[model samples]
Target: MDSRLAQHLLRRLRHQAGADAIDRATGAGLLTERRFRVAGRGVRTFVPGPLAAGRSEAEIARILERHAFAGSIARDDLPGDNDPAAVPEQSAGHDRSKSLDANGLLRAVRRSAEPLGAADVAAMLLLARSITMNTMPLGEILEALRLPAPIMTITGRVAGFEKTFLDLLEQGLVLPGKVASGEGHILSRDYDIRFSHVSDARWRVVVFAGTELDPEERERTARQVSLAAQSRYPILGVSEDEDRLPAVLRQAAGINLVSGPLDLGIIRDTMRAVLGQVPEGDIPHDHASALTLADLALAIRSGTSAKRALAVLDDLARIRMALAAENENDDGAASGKDSGRKETGSKTGKNSGRGNPGSGSERIEPAVPTGTETDRFIPRVETLSGYGKAGDWALDLKEDLALWRAGSLHWEDMSTKLLLSGPPGTGKTTFAKALCNTLRVPLIATSVATWLEPGYLGDVLIRMSATFAEAEAAKPAILFVDEIDGINTRGSAGEWTTYWDQIVNRLLELLDGSARSDGVVIIGATNNPDRIDKALLRSGRLERHIVIPKPDTEALVGILRHHLKGDLDAVIATAPERETGRTDTATADSTEADTASIATGEPAAAAPRRNEPAE
Candidate 1:
């Protein structure tokens, strides 16, 4: 999985994809092949370790895909000439604005065979991908797709204001207006869509009228959105004693204005009022360019700076509940409903602030889309308890956990950093899960063993980074790094010492509070805590330690009853007889019987008791 080997394999894939130049160069040994003699077959160079013995193209492709996912074989390594359609132009280091033209973009989107929507226009225009634009660059191939905020604009003078028609014509909406000498000079090209100003003022307007919209409704909705914009912004209204304009325009979210010339100050201010200075998130593909230009124009006009406004909205129910409680305390319970009016406006169009009102566009959260695999990271049933033993230690955890969840104090007050160390299978991992359950957060677990799977230093480092990134993205969660002992730097005195040093450094950086932004708590679990780097276990890191001992005689009986689901009263009652010996794991017979003897005595009793004083 080294860079050179990954490149070689990628070249092979490109060659198989019918890249004549790559095939010729590969045959010429420009991309030399290294051979690994595995299982009586000389597996060619660039083959993933698991598939080193694989001789089939399909197997090699699968391994190559895995490497691509692991961030080793980059997207640039793939050939684009063979089938540019199959290999999307958007990839590593590829800027869409350079390669993307409207024709190819429209063709790619239409190939998806999905009913398109309002939201798709912005994605199409920019050639950008997002959570909504899933499997993209490939295109969105879905059914029953719906999008909010259909774009439209209008003018004051109904038929005379030909300036509005130019926007449509340039967008490929209308053909060149037919007129004589007084008509506008027409600029036509076979390119899919382009935007510019037309010179002719008295030109005939003919909308291209594509099948994207239904015949009847298409022209009608277009007219509505178009004429309204013109009517609102009278070109000759300002400075000259022309038509009088409204003194103020109400600001509504989600209403994006097309960027261009603002002839009058009122028109400029009106556009700013609706669209705001921030410009919000992605515009529909068809309109992203126009909207971007529009934002730049507004930014230049307005002296005010813009800030992103996508913070958490207050819950209406919570506000009502608090209001209701206060009214009841003041002896106004019977008449509270008449005077207590709560306004929970939509996040997109309507605002709690008062202004001129009309029907507003509905808004939805654009990023981290719902119904995706990564949406809900938390994993626990409502009934999540009994993982911890019945004692002051467990009670203390519960007490702080409640305060932490209720936002009563800074999360750091509840031990943001903690270490859970114990013998294998002694509920170390279980405690990690239980901790998340106690806090009602998601559990994102990764291990040093899993990171080493790629069998390359850089590949493992990439995996580690990706895992941490996942935990970071899912907020208010717990990150559990299991088998952390694999990262031990104690006995490393070889060529790999420098390699291990990098990994330990990266791990420390992530857990050092330098990388975390969310309410994320990290828990590191290991059987041999003594083997871990002392730097990692120091204060401001995993400084708080909890040692989980082997399930004792009493705990073992409880475990048996829970698992059996049958009559375990007999087992619990007679469990005291087995006090002569108990295993760390239920099947501790796998370990030396001496551990059973030692665990049955003072060590088992002392570990649980020591945890109490630490708490």
Candidate 2:
């Protein structure tokens, strides 16, 4: 072994026992011979194998214990055997020292307070060090250091203050207050500190001992403590006074004040404790008016920036502009026609056709045809009739309409593939027609009974796709499909799924496409949304899931008033009286007489039968 190699082997043996070191040495082929001697306590012995040497005296002693090589080897002894595996044990003490230095534990204590009790200072020091080294934010550090046991113990020990220091912790200024427990004993006193911001650089520390203390004494103490801490640990602190505090502590650690009026000084100190100062720059000031309800609603829906939301409101305003223009045009045309009639010396009637003067005298136009196939279709005004429960149904429809207009609850987008489900004769179909009429848009009302055909699956898909395409081309129109669930229900296997899936897919595609296109809506009315497939309810696709709930009392009353045109007070009063047979004959006779007069178009000659009741 080389002499230097032997020394390295000995240094490696300090952390390992004899057998382990020999195993390592043998594995490395460093040991060729097997002979060694041991001499300690006036005893001499000889063993086998190679001897180990160390770089230092301590390592040499460890190596002797490992191989029982108690006898000393001289520098004259040539290299015996060297193992590649034999490596020195690195210093554990140095690594531990590095960790403590990195944590800045010692520096934190010296900066806190002199004559500070070891335990209290230790707790604060650990907390501050953890915050500084670990990059813990100020809030967390304050919480860890606010533990009552450590704080009170340290304060009592350092300031000779009593346990009443716990009371100081209760004041919200220092920390948040604690709730009292049973028998007037505090269950817990935990302080919560909120950090506004943390500085990027180390802060300068300023300790105020007292005004009476000479300035020289304060400076000496501060410098001595600061230097000692920085030398021992990774952190550094400096002392400062109020006038010089902000500039010195601009971005430094916390300061401890010993003798000033705490509240005012602390507030001013905190105000100066900003992360950094903002640079002066040009600032713009622009003011705008508050939005109206309609504008506000559009703003929320678009979720655009304030300026863009305002732009959307501007677009909606154009709708009102167009309406005003149309009104003005109508007025001008009426005036022009009236002037022409006076010039031509012909009397004008309301029915005068634009080109033909006497066309109205030839024949009367038929009442707007309902349920008839015509090229130019106009919606017929249907008289809504009510049955036992149907009268209350219309009210629900009105409530939903109100909700839609108010935007309290918005309707599905005009392009949404909606499913309006309810029991039959609940006005699902009528409501659909009414919406189309009210909006004055073309309604392509198709029924499942009419659309389904006995044909190939391809034919069905083609027809379904064509329907959506045509609806899209006819922009500003509603493709009102009634009983939609009929064509898309479960249990019809094979071609049914294929056909229905294609239909749903086509509907979703059209809905998505039309959402970007102007003025097309698809209103699908069904009696069973549950029976409809689940894929249609996804967002941005038939996104609105409106459950047309049954009518409540208020809604029912509105429906009755709108359609019946009957005396509500009389109906309500007479309802119970007639049911109980307590209605007087005079009132009953007058009601029957009025009904007969309405029905027959004749004056009533006699009173009604006493037994009969008015409906």
Candidate 3:
């Protein structure tokens, strides 16, 4: 056998034995190193015969196997049972009467005073057993323990191997190893055993119990162990367990598992948990009746646009009447049930007559028998203007508005349609409304979504015709279709062959009819003008294209002041010089023209126009 292996086995055997007892058993007869010259040429070293014959190899192997450290020792190399002792003086006090005599060895180990507890012994055995099977890696150990990988290293003083061993020594279970140069020789260390029959099963059970714990709790314990280990061993604490979470928390406690049907009782209980108790008399009981004709009249005079205002009033009235009827039915049902008798016709008549003054004798007519008079009071044509960014653009758009207002831009004779294309939110819709307001005519606003209703192809044409008829009746009206590109965009062949072609054809026909001698302007607003149908932009249709761009700094400042009520001084301070120059030049020209016109005693015929695009 290799000398190193022999030495390691000898150390392990000594650990199993009691080193002090071994020394006492041998007394001063124990071996000492001796060097002697051989043939006057070489020197040789040897241990004396008495110490060498202290224990047979078989006895050593048996002791190691009993302690579960057999891997470091081998049993087959022992001398046969029949063979006589090689050194008889070492076996002088041998007791052949006992099956195994470890008294000397035990005494020696006890003298060394190396102590190990049940838990430590178990852990060591488990490590040894696993290593014997070539599975010493911590990953496999954690798998056996059924733990999620630690997020951090296990550490601490109380739970680690070195601390546990130190604790054993303090408890008189271990004695200090050999010391040299003021440091203990770790290789000479050995554990003292108090019991001879330590069962592997008992040790395994203890280890299993220690390892079985909640994952988070296990991680905490591991960290404590690592801290303990670091005090003695130069170990880099790295997690070795896998990080995967378990699919089912089979051992989890304190959570309710619901796997059955839920009914109204469960729902009520859940609501109670979430919303708490309902108070008495919290339920709604009173409600206002529908708006009468008098109420509608009052609302119409309240500055709300008459038609829209009436529509709102009518809707509210209908809802109130429906609710009142439902309440009446509920009351009747409760009264009938309380009476506890079949309701006769005479009794019902009497009850109904008492409940309602004119019941059964007269009809309850709605407040308005006909909406015609209400319609007359409401303006058939109405317009709103001067709002948002579009209103600012409309100030510049006044010339176009004037032509329609003067009846010079008749719908039937005109060939060009109006294209108001601009960036979104810059008030395209507002400009369209302003134009209608300036013309003193109602707007017929339509967009692609409104026109493209399912199964409404024919209805679209009819609606278009009706709109034109309304505009002609109410002449000088603006027909504004916001997001015009949505309806008239270029598309793939399939779309062009199907929905697009039909929609475009209808729109073109409507544009042609509307852009005629009778004053009606077909104003189409789009962010993407390039997507509009070419035919619609042809002369005598929507030929006039007005592009609205971002406002200049002066215009922007003016818009900001209008929208946000900010201090103009701060804006003026930060205003670019180029914009100031333009403003100055315009003001100078206006002043010169004003002076000239005043000297001549006639007002200026024309105002100076801005070169910037309207936005």
Candidate 4:
């Protein structure tokens, strides 16, 4: 029994002599009130007796009251005075031969212009799409699809663009995203005559949200947006910058114009406009309006094209009839389903017991591949010396790589493995690659975090060993480990042991250079060496520690001399051409030497903060 029916029956039973006690405690979540009893065949207040309780005025009144209050659909919305089996009559203006009843028979052979269900939603979306698609019965679009009943859920998702724009401002970029579940199927069903639904076709709705866009970046983004939109779903570019957005999006795929805080207001107005009602200063709750085709066209058509605008007014009458037919289909489907549910104990169709699509049994994302894909080797480069000759940095690195590549008979004396540590942009990774370039060897780069992506501890250790094996395959090569401090045990205490301790131990065994390939050189680069485990930093694995510092005045001058050769004359000299503009190399080199004395062999790129403003 329905909750209201149960409530009414309980209230009536409460007035009965013996049922007073049960009624006193009835105001909780208890669904039903029952008592062991045997009432007569015509009893109206008991279960399994409604079938025999015919012609009783009290029972009939109670059933009618329940339908009026507790129905899924409001009783007033149902057709034919709430009669389940009643066939509706045709409109006065409907054509005699154009009968659209369930069997193509006359709904009564008379017709008059009626209203459409989708007209409201169509108008709302048209308002969202804003200016262009007026006077086209655009609001009645869904009613045109597969005899569609317009029941679209329109949500003006301002959060998507607001968060997107602000995030881009933070990153110094406002990128666009794709629109997954809008447009096509909806448009197809709603405006089937003008546009057929293309379910598989999806285009991106890229947002361009910044105050200004770089010419090159803008060009690139525009090209990507167009190509993607043309081939797939039309891009609905949501723009926030008022001045720049209109011009930039004039030729773009699709655009929605909205101001930051006023976006919600714009959507509300558009929905009201589509629903054929005057937008109130506040949202309106009265869902009834009498906007005819002429009224909507007058509202939508922005220009003096009254002749063309009135031409489409005739179509609205047909639209109203079509909408009514589709609505009858909707009502029938709902009633049929309700009847089925009432008769059978089990659910049927659509959401029947196959289980909810969005349940918790989703699969975990696949782990990163620890095989050949990660083993890609970096090519050899010229020299790190040009990057910074703080201590003839390039020459010393080249010599080390050359000796190792030559497979020196006394290779152990060379101490193949080294650790490079310094502040960012100190040329650690660059110098490591330069070392490989000079040796004419391959550079295999991997990080500890990549190995740990497999989740479990045992898997990470195996991944770590596999990386070393791949590096050994390209023996006499530099294995550059970027961000090696990720496995540091500095903060790993009693509880964190389950993580860092295992990784640090496995890394120690892999560092034994002599036991495996003699040519395998492990060069770990990090900004913080203090965080690494002391045992792994012992005299064998990562035997040498190199510190890369910012360039000093002299080193900066040298690095500048090497790069800004011709550019310097342009910068400093205002005088006319000098064919023999030879610069003094020795003076510039000594100028660098005099300023700072760094650990001469630790080859890091120069990062001098000579002109950087103090923080």
Per-candidate Cα lDDT values, in order, are: 0.38, 0.36, 0.39, 0.40
TM-score of every candidate relative to the true structure: 0.33, 0.27, 0.29, 0.30
Worst 10 residues of 3 by lDDT: 356-365
Query: Candidate 3: misplaced stretches above 4 Å?
Result: 1-416, 463-470, 488-496, 565-615
**Residue 244 CA error for candidate 2 (Å)?**
99
Best by TM-score: 1
For candidate 1, the per-residue lDDT at 583 reads: 46
Candidate 4: list runs displaced more than 4 Å. Answer: 1-408, 513-515, 558-615
What is the RMSD of candidate 3? 39.4
Count the clashes in each prediction.
24, 14, 45, 25
Residue-by-residue lDDT tens digits, candidate 2, 27-113: 323232344445633432222223332222233323333433322323333233263123334653322122222113222211221
lDDT, candidate 4, at 89: 38
lDDT of 3 by residue, 255-293 (tens): 111110111111122222222321111101011112322
RMSD for each model, in Å, please?
Answer: 27.5, 35.2, 39.4, 31.1
Q: Which of the two candidates, 1 or 2, achieves a greater TM-score against the reference?
A: 1
> Tens digits of per-residue lDDT for model 1 on 68-118?
223233344433345443233343444323432333322222222211111
